[model samples]
Structures are given as structure tokens and as C-alpha cells.
Target: MRTIKPVQMRSPVLTVRRVDTYHAITVVAPGVAERFRAGQFVAVAVGGDTSSMLARRAFFIHDVKPDYGGTVEFVFEVRGRGTSWLSECRSRDLLDVTGPLGRPFPLPRDPVNCVLVGDGHGASPLFPLAHTLRRRGCRVDFVLGAAGAQRVFGALAARRVGETATFATRDGSLGLRGRVTDALPQVIEDARADVVYGVGPLPVLRTVTAIAAKYGVPAQVAVEERMACGIGLCMTCVLPVVGDDGVTRMLRSCVDGPVFRGEQVRFDDVGTIPFDALGAPGWKARPDDSASTEIGQ
Candidate 1:
């Protein structure tokens, strides 16, 4: 019979420092913040109860700070029952948390015109990415997309890390008055992006992948998959992948990666393939939003 191993864990009532509606959720989890990485995630049990949750909800690490005991950060749109619960908690309430899970985004080998594209909560991880890129002397250009201006990244904050940045909104309520993908041509053309990294809706990633392919720019994506165990034991969230040898394979997005190259992922084959065939429970479509789209595999 399948079983769950006991994991020694800590719970804390994280005060909600700030809420960037479309951008992120800044939490004051002092000791846990600095430990996470860009693209990595944490599984949280609201109100410290996992009984009804079945599986802890996974959220993107987004960003963390070493100070304030290193508060961990997550940016997500309110789309499900778990998060709606999260929204109800008071500023200083603790949560049952486990993680620093999932593979992190890749750091550039050398400074290239790295383009960071993310929309809404997907934009969370770009902070560290942009920071790391700037530290390495790589020119960074960030393009953020969201429903409206209220749903955007920390603008002045991002400008502090990246050299140049742009914004686009679906309702034309913000920067470009269009989708992030719509501003790609302009962002790419203006910044001369040579390496591209993205996190957002699958459709957004798909569009980014195509643009990168057309431009011959090396790009990577942080894929969001439903995860139950948060460990490799559950074959619930396997994503089709190609190995270094060019052979097709299956990889667990929760463990092996949340980060994958634009080329390695079988994007076209995702929703089409049967789940049982891919070492997962069943084909559960995790549509667009990377936030609420949980892969309870």
C-alpha cells in the first residue's frame, strides 16, 4: 500500500506584508525566505490542516529576502479554494509549509541579453533571476504581462535589478494595452534579447517558445504541474522530456524540474497524451494560469 513518510516540519503564522494582486504575495516568513530559489515552490496547508486538502497546494517561490529572517515570497492570483483560505488568514498566522521543492531556473553561463518574460504571478521568480543576471553583468530585459496595472510586478523594484523593462496588459489597462507576447517584438527588438526565460500561462510559454525558436535565442521555461506528494514517489506530474542524449523521456516537474529548456519540453504533446501512458495517474489538463493550476499528481 502507498504511504506518506513523516516529515519534521515547522509552522508559522506568516504576516501578509503586501499583496500584489496579479504579481505576488509577500509573506513575512523570516527564516524560510532566503532558502528558496527562483522557480522553486513550496507546498502549503492552509490553517495547518492537511486532512481535507488531500495534498498541500504548491506555489512558486517567487522571491525571498535574507533579512526579516528571510521572508519567503509567493505571487499568485486567487483562483482556488486553498488560496482563498490563504487570503483569509491574518497577517501573523502560521501555515504548514514544506519545500524549496522543484528544480530552479537556470542561471546564464555568460552575460547575454537575457530576456525575462512573465505574467501576473508568473512574474514572481524573475526578481532573483534578474538580480542574478545583473550581478553577473548580463544585460537583463524584463517583460511583464497582467490583467491590468493593478496586476503587475513591482515596477520600481524590478527597475532596481534589471537594466530595461517593459509591461503589457490584457485589457490595455497598463503599459502596452495588450498581452506580454504582443510586446515581445518591441521588447526583443529594443533590448536585443539573446536568451529568454519565461514563467506564466502555458499558452504564454507556448508563444514565448515560438518566438525564441523563430529568433534562435536559447530560452527556458518554468513549467507548473499539479503535485500531490511534492516528491518523486508520486508519478502524478510527469512531463515529457528529451534528455541530453536527444532521447525522449519522462521527467517529474516537481522534483526533476519546474525549469526546462524551451526545446526539451514536449509542449505540443502535453494535453494530448494520456496520463497513464506518461507514468502519471491520468491526463488532467492544467490549463493556463500557472498559479491555481495544481497538478495533484
Candidate 2:
């Protein structure tokens, strides 16, 4: 859980720029910047005050700058009306933002060999995480992937930040011609990684977890879930996760995670609650015709 409480404020836009295939927005959010941890996210209210769009768009905190009091930057690809509106935002625009939300990536207590994997804009958070790891004496390596070269975020930065940077593109437009996961196993092996960290869509995370398991290394993954609210109040982002007690519970991604032990997540059961999950219907009893009839009566 986060020790710093998130604050909602009308933050002033500091910069808006196009970064290859993504848009990067920096806002003057001192509160968020000061308390931010890599892998945490922010939710921005779009469509101004009167527009009908109700849900706040969630974005990972890409980076933070200490200048001008403090500022937080986030990157995104404009996929719909809400994001399109965000792209048009200019300097000095006041956007309602709430963040440094979600549980952040937990840092290791001792320096170790680490491999970080990212996909598309999901690579945003890993850059900052790599920096932190290096400062803690961890050797950082990167495996970044996207559909094409232009879509792969932070390749040049990865080269500079990591001990070695490996890239994969499905179209053969970059490093290796395959999914990022295709490059993951080799990177982990060569780096002699003690731990693997990943950020991407659910399927990618699932594959990353499997690869780490094969190498007998622990995996920490940040998941991409459609969050209706960036707070725990909304149950929209719940996913099945096995706790230390071996109980499968539907945990909220916003608060309980966006970052979780990769092995503990029931990735295949993400969209549906597992029948045996705690509190799930029929977890204790098998539903049958007699039970249904009794309930009806």
C-alpha cells in the first residue's frame, strides 16, 4: 500500500509533446511528483468541467521533474474521444488530476541482476524503475517491444539506462523480429537475472510470469486493466490473485495492485471470477437445481 495519500487538484499543464507514437503530458503537480513511485499512475479528468465524459483516464507516471516546484509526466496513445481531448491540451490548461495512485513496484533490498520487459507505451514506467534500480546497485537490463520501431518507447533511453538493451518488433522494424516475450528468456539467462520485472497488457504479463518461472526467478508485473476509477472504490478492476494463505481472492487492481507478484495472479481468470475464489458465488456450495429452487421459494 502507498504511504503517501493521493491528492486531487486542478493541475496546470506544463508541456505537451509528441513522442514517436505517444503523447507525453507534464503537469505542475508538486504533490504527486514528490510522492510518486515508479509504476504508480495518475487519473486525469477529461472533457473539461461540463462535458459528458465521466471516467477519468488513467496513465502511468512516466517521469517526474523537480523543477518548477515539481512536475509529473505521463505518456499515452490517443485511442478515443477522451484521449483525443487530452492530446489537444496546451500549456496552462487546467486539468483535474488525481494521483500518485496504486501500489508501486517494490524495490529489492539488495542489489541483484534484474531484467525489465515492456511493451509499447507500457514501457513508460520501466525507465524510471531502471534508474532507481541502478542507484541501488542493481544491474539493469531491458527488453522492449512493440508492433514497429516507432511504437517501441524508450529504446535509446534504455540503451543509456540499462547495462544492455534488447528490443523486439513484430514487423522486424527493430532489434529482434518477434514479440517482446520472444527476447525475454535469453535476456534473463544472459543477464543471470535474480529477478524479472515486467509491464504490459495481461497476456504479455502472463507470458513474462511463465518465463520467469522457467528460470526459477521471481517476477514482479504491473498489469494494464481498464480502471473506471483509479481508486479502490470501483470494483471494475478486480482480478483473481492467490494470497500467501493460498486463498484465491478477487483483489482490486487500483489499490491492491497494478503491481503484483506475477505468479500469484490467476491471469487466465482475469475477466471472470474463479468459482473457488473467496466470496465468489458457489465457492462453498455447488449450485444445483435444488439450490436454485430453494432460493426461488
Off by over 4 Å in 2: 285-297
Residue-wise lDDT of candidate 1 within 1-297, one digit each (tens)?
122232324545455544556424456654455456567788777545444766677788767776556567776566777677777666666677776777777676787888899887677778877887888889988888888887887666667677777889888877898889888877777888888999887788888988888887877898767777777788788777755544345777777777888777778777544342333464332354232322222
List the candidate 1 regions with Cα displacement exceeding 4 Å.
1-8, 17-34, 274-297
Q: State the lDDT of candidate 2 residue by residue for 1-297, as single tens digits.
A: 327899998999999999998999999999999889998999999999999999999999999989899999999999999999999999999999999999899899999999999999999999889999999999999999999999999999999999999999999999999999999999998999999999999999999999999999999999999898889887999989887656678888888889999999999998998988877787763443122211100
Show how many residue pairs clash in every candidate, following the order shown: 12, 0
- The candidate that achieves the highest lDDT relative to the unseen native structure: 2
The per-model lDDT (C-alpha) reads 0.71, 0.92
Ten-residue stretch with the least lDDT total in model 1: 288-297
Q: What TM-score does candidate 2 reach?
A: 0.95
